[model samples]
Structure formats: structure tokens, C-alpha cells
Target: MSRSPTFVRALGYLALALFLGMAVVLRFVIGPDVSFTPQAEIGRYSDADLVALGAELRETGQAGLYKFILLGVDFVFITVFGLWVMLVHAIRGLGPVRWVGVALACAFMALDYGEDLMLAIRMGLATKGNLDPAVLTNPVSLVHYVTLAKFAVFALCMLSVYFVSRRRA
Candidate 1:
């Protein structure tokens, strides 16, 4: 292989390693257990029930932290992936359909990143327990799934590079 091809492959693998490594760190070290919790509107019940309900409500705050952590992973993964795709294209040609997949992946990753940033800010505010009623009602579930999907997409991109390099095209 040419020096450029070899270099590109090295960078791609490095990026993938960084992406997955960070993901693992987030899942275990960062705060996964603290982040995935439920947040229902429990204030509607009697004030006497507020103690038990309050505890449940607090669990949802962990969900917010969960998303904040995921946002960190998603942002790093997509930004690196965007570069990785362009690198693969330069090193080995791919059809327009494959290019479209890269483009779509970038778009999905971008959305995931933006949503995470927004949630992180809101979560910081929520930590102070000053969050608005409407904000509290908003669940972190959506962001959670989207962030996980972002990682999955990045993994697909990494695997595609190997296939692309091996193919005749």
C-alpha cells in the first residue's frame, strides 16, 4: 500500500478506538448507573405523598446526567467520524450511495451532538432543582436512544472502511 493509504487506515483505526474507548468509559466510569432513571410527574399527588414521590422524581435527574455524559461521547465520535469518512473516500473510492450513507451518518451524529449539548445545559440547571415544570416533564429517553444510535453509526462507518479497502472499486 502507498504511504497515504497506510496512513489513512491508521488514522481510521485510531479514531474508532478512541470512539469505542470513550464509550466504554462513559458507560462504566462516567455515570451510567446514575443517569438511567425515570422522571414522572408525581407532584399531582397529595402533599403527604411528596416524600416518596420526591425520591422517585430525583431518580430522573440521574437520567439528565446520563444524557449529558452521552452527549460527550456523541460529539467526539461524530466529529471524528466526519473526518474518517472523508479520509476513506480519499484513500479508496466508493459509490455515491455509500457517500450518501456517510452524509446521513454525519447528519444523524450532528443531531445527536446538538441535542446532547442542549440537554447538558438544561441538566446543569436542573441540578440546582430550579428547572421549570414543563422541563421536568420532558424525559431524557429520546436523547438516550439517539446518542446510542450515534455510536452504532460510527461503528458501522469503521467497519465499512475495511470492506471498502478490500473491494475492487
Candidate 2:
């Protein structure tokens, strides 16, 4: 069964609010001006770069907190938000097949959250002063591949929105 239009819209708005709030926290609170912002291009990070990131996380006490925020909150919320974006069109009469976007959103979330978890594990090791580059090869490679897939899916989802709008217009 499908969800109500009002409920879906509310979820979408709530996701937006969470996103905005997190952006504020990332930019103003646990930010570059104080703590080194975590790298967005994590897939490109070398072993040394990961070590440096760990050191930054350790130095700024962001290792633990950011892990929770990124994996637990941001990842989940953004996935749900993307679902709402993709589904709203279908609910409004685009077609039921558009629900496939929901599946794609979940895949994006898995890739993103998996990447974050790998980094978080490294950060935890860094906090303990036990980070070893030799152990990072697999996770780093996985993160790189996942990041690529995640972005590709996300781009497709966004395009669906654009096309849907243009078709409606």
C-alpha cells in the first residue's frame, strides 16, 4: 500500500529540516574554523590522507561524534528524503514504477553509510592511536567504489525530478 500525500510531504519537509540543521552544525559548530572538516572526497584519500583525517578527528574530538551524526542521522535522513523526492512524483500520478527510485535511494544510502562506517572505524582506531595503513586498503577501495556508485544513482534520481517537472510543465 502507498502512503498518504500529506504524510509523505511531511516526511520530505522533515528531512529537509534535518539536512539544514546538520549543515549549520557542520559549517558553524564542528567546522573547519575550529576542527578540520572531514573530507568530502574520501574516496580519493590515500592511506596517509586517512591517517591525517584520523589525526584531525582525534585532535578535535570529532571521531566519535561525527561517526554517529554521519552514519546514524545524516545517512538515514537523506535516504528517506531522496525517497520522498522520487515518490512524490509517482504519488501525484507520475506512475507506480517511479517507486523504483525508492530502491535506488536505499542503494545510495547503503553505499554512503558503508563508506562512512569504514572511515569511522579508521577514526576510532586513530583515536586509540592504533591506526595502521596496511589494514586500510580494502575499506578505502570499497569506499571509492561505493562513492562512485552512490553519486551515479543520485544523479539519476535528481534527473528524474527535473524531467518530471519539465514533463508537467
Candidate 3:
């Protein structure tokens, strides 16, 4: 049976609320209390040094990759948001499938949160009343690759759920 457009839109709103709600709680509420904000938390690396690093990246091979990634993420976020709409409509319509979109969203955001946490940890900021001494090590740079992969996996899971749910719809 098909659902009213209003009901479907309401479901979409609920899904979106769940998505943005976690993001907000993480960013504004939990993040500050447990993050590696260098200027405010670590403060060992001077701002000037960070500025130089940014300049260096802009002039090096890494800049293209970074820019490509940032652009890719912009597209990804849009896709995920669109999926929320699809899932919401499906749920309101009372189709055979349930929990697919929510499941994917949960998994996606889980890794997203995890990667963010790992990056925070890598920054070596003092959390839990302990400061990271090896914050500036070159070895830590490699870890970013793993974090990026986790992020990609999160996106893949989200996309997969969206497509699966969409196909079912």
C-alpha cells in the first residue's frame, strides 16, 4: 500500500533528524569534551608551523589528492542525504523492507565517528588528563591512510544500504 506524501516526508524528516542529531551531538556536545583541538588543547605546535605545513601541502603532490578527497566528500554527503529521503518514503509506505536504511546510516556514522576519534587521538592532544608526547612523529602520518579507509568504508556501507533500500522500494 502506498502512503501519503505528507507521511513519507515526515519519515524523511525523522531519518534526517536522526542523522543530523548524532552529528550535532558529536560535534558540539561530545567533541569538545574529548577532542584534539591543537590550538586550544595541544598548543605545542605553533600556529606558524601549521600554516607552513598547509603552504607546503598546497605546493606539493599531496594537494591534488586532498582537494580531490574534499570534493568527493561534498558529493558523498549529498548522496547520503538523498538516501535518507528514499528510506523515509519506503518506511512510511510500509514496504516489506525495514531497518535497511537505518542500519546503514548507523554503520556509516559509526565509522565516521571512529575515524574522527582516531584522528583526534593522532593529534596527540591531552585527553583523559594525558598528553600525547609523540604527537609530532612522522610514523603517525601513515595512520591517516587507515583512517581514510575507514571513512571510505563508512561511506560504502551507507551507499550500499541506500541502494539496497532503493531497489526494494
Q: Which candidate has the highest TM-score of all?
A: 2
Assess each prediction's global lDDT (C-alpha) against the native: 0.52, 0.62, 0.43
Order the candidate numbers by lDDT, best to worst. Answer: 2, 1, 3
Ranked candidates (TM-score, high to low): 2, 1, 3
Number of clashes in model 2? 0
Q: Model 2: per-residue lDDT, tens digit, 24-89?
A: 877776677343444345335544455566677668787666666776677767777777765665
Worst 10 residues of 2 by lDDT: 33-42
User: Model 1, range 1-169, lDDT digits (tens) per residue?
Assistant: 3334666666667767866775565556443434222121212232223222234334644443445444555566666667767667555655674685567557656765665554454444224434455645543334445555655665676566666666664
Query: Which prediction has more favorable lDDT, 1 or 3?
Result: 1
Error of 2 at 47 (Å): 3.7
Candidate 1 stretches greater than 4 Å from native:
1-4, 32-74, 125-132, 148-152, 155-159
Highest lDDT scorer: 2
Candidate 2 whole-model C-alpha lDDT, 0 to 1: 0.62
